[model samples]
Target: MMNRLFGKPKPETNALQTLDKLNETLEMLEKKEKVLLKKAGQEVEKAKEYTRSKNKRAAIQCLKRKRLYEQQVEQLGNFQLRIHDQMIMLEGAKATTETVDALRSGASAMKAMQKATNIDDVDKTMDEINEQTENMKQIQEALSTPIGAAAEFDEDELEAELEELEGAELEEQLLQPTTVLPSVPAGRQQARPIPKRTAEEEELAALQAEMAL
Candidate 1:
């Protein structure tokens, strides 16, 4: 029984360590793939130069090297894909574990809540809430009512005052007199004439002067 419990422990640890190593290997493969891509480009350039120099063998060799590099890159891609699949599986497992834990916690919380409350207490609480609401409503209505005081003017008195104002207006209109203006002529306006100096005026002036002398 103890063997059954512990026999698989080392295997599990080794599996985890293998996955870690695989992750590191995948990263290294990706780096190597990038380097190989650069090398392939360089080989293409080298082939072009060799072709320009009329060296057919050297150009063909460079092309071969570029193809080999591409093959290695393809192999590296396969390795990366495998690593991605493993990571996705692990993530799914983790999410499933968290989901189960959350469900269990919720179930426990609901059980505790069920124990903490009773229907009778809920009904009593509701009754108290309704009573307070009614009391507050009554208080608001009481505060809104007018205190004891007689109105300064009743409705009939107000109507009588309005009629008096209308009568005064009518009387004032009857007392005002209507006026008429005289019509003016449309001729040229004339000013008052100055007195003329005549012989009689001269003689009177001369006689007054002789009397003074």
Candidate 2:
């Protein structure tokens, strides 16, 4: 009833809205500060003119007004500083809030995942995968084996056949004709030179030849 009477005490403003409000206030303070500074400068100029005219009282009054304007400018500067500080703190708080919210969302998602899956389901899936792998291995082994590889063979009969083939090859080689080469002459006959004989030796040779005839 109290809320109804107060017309629903307006919703709490968010960080962005608060920061925008602060910026507007800061801008207004700066504008006021500028106007005050300008007024102080004008006061100083009026004081100078009064002093030149030898009106000491008027110059003193202008100086007092200048002091007041400077004081107001200083106050505006302090207000701007407070606004900037508030904005910085609010932005920091906003960042912190966003970080917390992100962490909370991640935790909730993890909790949901945990609820959906259990250890027994994981074990069953692993078992199915292992069975499939074993079946695939068996299929591969079956395909790689040669046909009739399980049939028995007679090693002794195979050896006997190999020996028979080798014997036939040797006999065929022996049936081929042998080649013969012509014989070389022993040596060539050479003419021998007669030795020069002395006259007595020649007569003795001739006498021997006559006696032989």
Candidate 3:
């Protein structure tokens, strides 16, 4: 029983680490593909040179080497494609795992919060918030109030002061001077002076009297 329980072997590599290694291998393959392509071009040039010199066997050999290099390049391309497919699949799986884990954590936290709070507690908290809000509004209103004793003056005192001013103005008007026009007498005509007669005037008057007699 002990042998059966302990007989299983451990994994030689972690999956993520294996994927990283595979990516490196794909990169190496791409580098090899580039090198092979350069070699193929060189071989084609060699084949052309040999054909121009009429060395048919050498030309054929060069052509054969170029074909082999192309085959290896094709194989490397397939390997890179496989590595790309594996990476895409691994990345998708990793994203899905993280998403599920995040959702689970959020749900657990919400459940814990719900377990910690009751309806009565929620109502009490809301009442506290409303009380605080009202207190803040009252404080703001007090702060915004106008400064000085004007806010404290009694309405009756103000009315009394206004009446006193009006009374003082009336007394000043009564103290001013009153003017009266002079009256003239009616119905009194003045007499003019009469002239007195001289002595010559009397003699002439006597002569006339004698002639009449």
Question: Which stretches of candidate 2 lie above 4 Å from their native place?
Answer: 1-13, 127-213
Best by TM-score: 2
RMSD of each: 16.1, 17.3, 22.2
**After TM-score superposition, what is the CA distance of residue 129 in candidate 2 from its true location, in Å?**
5.2
Indicate the worst ten consecutive residues by lDDT in candidate 1.
7-16
Q: Order the candidates by TM-score, highest first — what do you get?
A: 2, 3, 1
Q: Considering only N, C-alpha and C atoms within 3 Å, which residue pairs clash in candidate 2?
A: none
Query: What TM-score does model 3 achieve against the real structure?
Result: 0.49
Candidates in order, TM-scores: namely 0.41, 0.56, 0.49
Off by over 4 Å in 1: 1-23, 108-213
- Model 3 lDDT per residue over 13-48, tens place: 345776788888988998999999999999999999
What's the distance in Å from true for residue 32, model 2? 0.4
**Local distance difference test values of all predictions, in order:** 0.87, 0.90, 0.89
lDDT of 1 by residue, 46-162 (tens): 999999999999999999999999999999899899888887776676567678878999999998887677778888999999999999999999888666664344779889999
Candidates sorted on lDDT, descending: 2, 3, 1
Best by lDDT: 2
Q: Candidate 1, clashing residue pairs?
A: none
